[model samples]
Target: MPLSEIKIDDEVFVSEGTVGVGAVRQVTPRELTIYIEGYGDIAIGPDHIASAHDGKVVVKPETLPGAIQAHLEHVHDGEYRRPSDT
Candidate 1:
């Protein structure tokens, strides 16, 4: 998704990366900040984001340094997110 489109509380995903999911905490012109359990908050730049689909931002794990460990958060797969959900 476009950086402009991302917002606080939005969900994030990983593509062949460490953190499987993240909760968006902040979005700025430069990057998107997401919080992962046991990992804390992380800022993701556009280059690492693979794509935007189904209202989620998919990021590449390799792009995230020091994110070697792996874990997954609840995604509620296929659950449609409403505008108010953001």
Candidate 2:
């Protein structure tokens, strides 16, 4: 299963490690924005997503940090401002 097939509100988890869990908040053609508790919303790309199935999306643990960074860069480029950025 690919990340492109993930549905909104589906539970996502770091299936390979003890990272964290989150819910899919938004989905786009290029990314999946997940609302991770304590970490806020992070957009994950296909490269970071290992698989998605049975109402759960598993992300590659090693790519988690990079995904978060990419999301931050994306948000900074858009009009939406994260609270911590203020």
Candidate 3:
């Protein structure tokens, strides 16, 4: 689904993981930011999204790491990097 279709309050579900459920709190041209109770906000792109409708978004858990990296870079202005990267 296009990011344009996503709206606030949309519920986000991962195919499988401890990610549980999250609610869309903010939307931007690049990603959708969802708030998960215990996990906090996570920024993600549409590539991992399997489908979206009826105020819900289903995503692939495997892409989570890349999603997070995008978030960090977006917010930090390239000041941070994956710890293991040389």
Candidate 4:
């Protein structure tokens, strides 16, 4: 997809072993800079990401205040699930 088509609250697979949803903060022809809820803003190559949305509501973005707690919840809950294979 074109960079103009991407948006905030979109999940993207940056690479194998590097998949984190990004909250779009800025955009450019060659990059889509995003403020990953827990990781802060980082500029990722447009070609390096695979958009993870399929026009379905699988996951939703959280508000800023809820971001921390949600991350904690995911982490806490992760202890019980099998690790993902990159």
Clashing pairs in 4: none
The sequence of per-residue lDDT tens digits that candidate 2 reaches over residues 1-85 is: 3556789998877674433367899998889898865559877789988878777888775777875645533432434645895
Of candidates 4 and 3, the better by lDDT: 3
- What digit string (tens of lDDT, one per residue) describes model 4 on residues 1-44? 46766665555433334444445677687776666545577565
Model 4, position 44, has a per-residue lDDT of: 57
The candidate that wins on TM-score is 2
Q: TM-score per candidate, in order? A: 0.65, 0.66, 0.65, 0.43
- How many clashes would you count in candidate 3? 0
Ranking 1 against 3 by lDDT, winner: 3
In model 1, pairs of residues that clash are 17-61
Model 2: lDDT of residue 7: 94
Per-residue lDDT of 56 in model 3 = 78
**What tens-digit string does per-residue lDDT give for candidate 3 at 1-86?**
58999999988766433233668999888898888545578777887688787777877666678655344233434335568865
Name the regions of candidate 3 deviating beyond 4 angstroms.
16-20, 66-86
- Candidate 3 accuracy as lDDT: 0.70
Please give the lDDT score at residue 76 for candidate 4: 31
- Scored against the true structure, residue 53 in model 3 reaches a CA lDDT of 79
How well does candidate 4 score on lDDT at residue 34? 65
